[model samples]
Target: MMRKQTPWLALALLTLAPAALAQKTKVDAPPKKLYCWNENGQRVCSDALPPEAVNYAREEISAKSGLRTGEVNRTLTAEERAQAAAEAAQRALDKAAEDTRRRTDQAMLMSYRTEDDLRRVFNERTAIVDNNVQTARYNVASLREGLISLLQTAGDRELSERPVSAEMTQNIRLRHAELVRQRQLQASFESQRGELDIEIEDILQRYRTMKGSLPADSAPAATTP
Candidate 1:
């Protein structure tokens, strides 16, 4: 009877030991952390984030998550992209124009130290053009005389009751063509002279403005005709 009672007691202890160990494990386990997802402006929370959270901003702060707070991220819209490109293009244009202005101002200041110096340069440049104009005028005058001489020769032949020789006809035509070329040259020279005049006036006015000779509020200096 005593031996049978010992076997029963050992079996009862083995079953009680398993129950105690299970209870200890349950108490020692860590609590499950909560995760949340933001859908549009709404907050949806659970033990894990929903599949839609992949497209939305996530809120991990447990306290802040209850307030439904999260940051939204997205690509720019079409209109936004176009406006950004336009602004960048405008910036590039402005930078290029500014660079050109700076370079021009530097060159202008370096070329002339005084108003008299500017005038001297202007005169020198115009004098060269003036000489060209003079040469062109002389050439035109000479060609006109040659044309007149040819016309006179043709008149003489007709007055004497002789046929205008092919050679004389050709000579008159050649002289006329030469006269036309000279006149064209003269016209081009005059046009160039006018351009030089305008360019010189523009430079002078700019130089005066840079030197502070003209009042800042005053209108541009009137160029001499």
Candidate 2:
């Protein structure tokens, strides 16, 4: 009653196993590329894409991009918006300081007799004027950024459309005050520079006059130490 196994039968079973598996398998088509050939033998671009591929390099790249774009569409939190505005204002302030320094240097160079003159004898009104201009630019950027954001949020909330706030009102007052101060400072510096230029011109004229009046036979006098 014991059954015997045959090697030829086992080999035949193995040969038929692959065919049975193939019958159970699903249909698979060749991968499609994203590009299409134009009538002129060139590829035309489109937003749509083709079917899946083995490499999927392009699809992986697109997946990352989609994630980034989704992030972009997501709303900025209140804290984030405020922080961004503050950082922008800080950067503007730093640049204003740099601008003021450069303007002060240029103004002093134009009117000053020596490097020491900037600190010693020369006027400092131009530096005040430059400070005003830089301050104005800074305020403009800061205020505009804040206003735009506020207006955008207000529109989103469907609140009153007018762009106004206590902070903005205070900024406006400061801006006017700075403008007036800048004008007065500029006037003072300009008048001082004018006076200095006249003095230099008179000195040069007198020197020429004295040289023309000198006698040809006179010997030059040497200075004693």
Candidate 3:
């Protein structure tokens, strides 16, 4: 399990280390049971002698851990260099993704403004569309009514020459023109709508690409060996 706080763990270890060091047991060799006196016939035994050096497990802890050490030390290896290169590449990828996102946002904002203006134009043109449709409908209704009256009067009489009245011929020509003009305006609106749709799709595609390049937010990989 992970510690809630490593600072406290370090402090506790430091506090115990001094006391453990003070508790070191001294080991020494006692003199011989019978020793000869210096240049005399008398014999005497000497007391114990002190140890050569102090002994404690905690004494060399700092040296082993590379703290307060001498010239001997470990150098950075090839594997460490590779790991540093990997980290630098990762940072570059992140920066590129961030820049892409910024550019896409600017493009989307411009597209949105353009769409708003186009939408207004579409609304205005669609109004003219409604008017054209109604006018076409009125003309068609009147033309059908006149044809029915003529058919009732002269059944099965083909009039390909079609020169009955000047006003009637002009009415037929004008109604045909109105219908053709309506189709043209409808086509115009559809063309503008298609271009607007493409711009919207392009903006969305860039957004998805930028989002896909982001790194996952899971656990980080261990870098220390």
lDDT for each residue of candidate 1 in 1-225, tens digit (9 for 90 to 100): 465445877898998999999999988975444556556677776766566565555555345245543444534668988999999999999999989977986576666666775687667778888998999899889888988988888899899998989998998888789889888988998999999888778867777777685355643443343
Residue-wise C-alpha lDDT for candidate 2, range 71-137, written one tens digit per residue: 1122356897899999999999999988996685444334544334333432354465456556655
Top of the candidates by lDDT: 1
TM of each candidate vs. truth: 0.49, 0.28, 0.29
TM-score of candidate 3 versus the correct structure, residues matched by position? 0.29
* Full candidate order by lDDT, most accurate first: 1, 2, 3
Winner by lDDT between candidate 3 and candidate 2: 2
Query: In candidate 3, what are the lDDT values of residues 49-88, reduced to their tens digit?
Result: 1131111111111322434321222234689779989999
lDDT of candidate 1 at residue 56, scale 0 to 100: 56
TM-score-wise, the better of 1 and 2 is 1
Which parts of model 1 have CA positions greater than 4 angstroms off? 1-102, 213-225
Of candidate 3, the 10-residue stretch with the lowest lDDT total is 52-61
Measure candidate 3: CA RMSD: 33.3
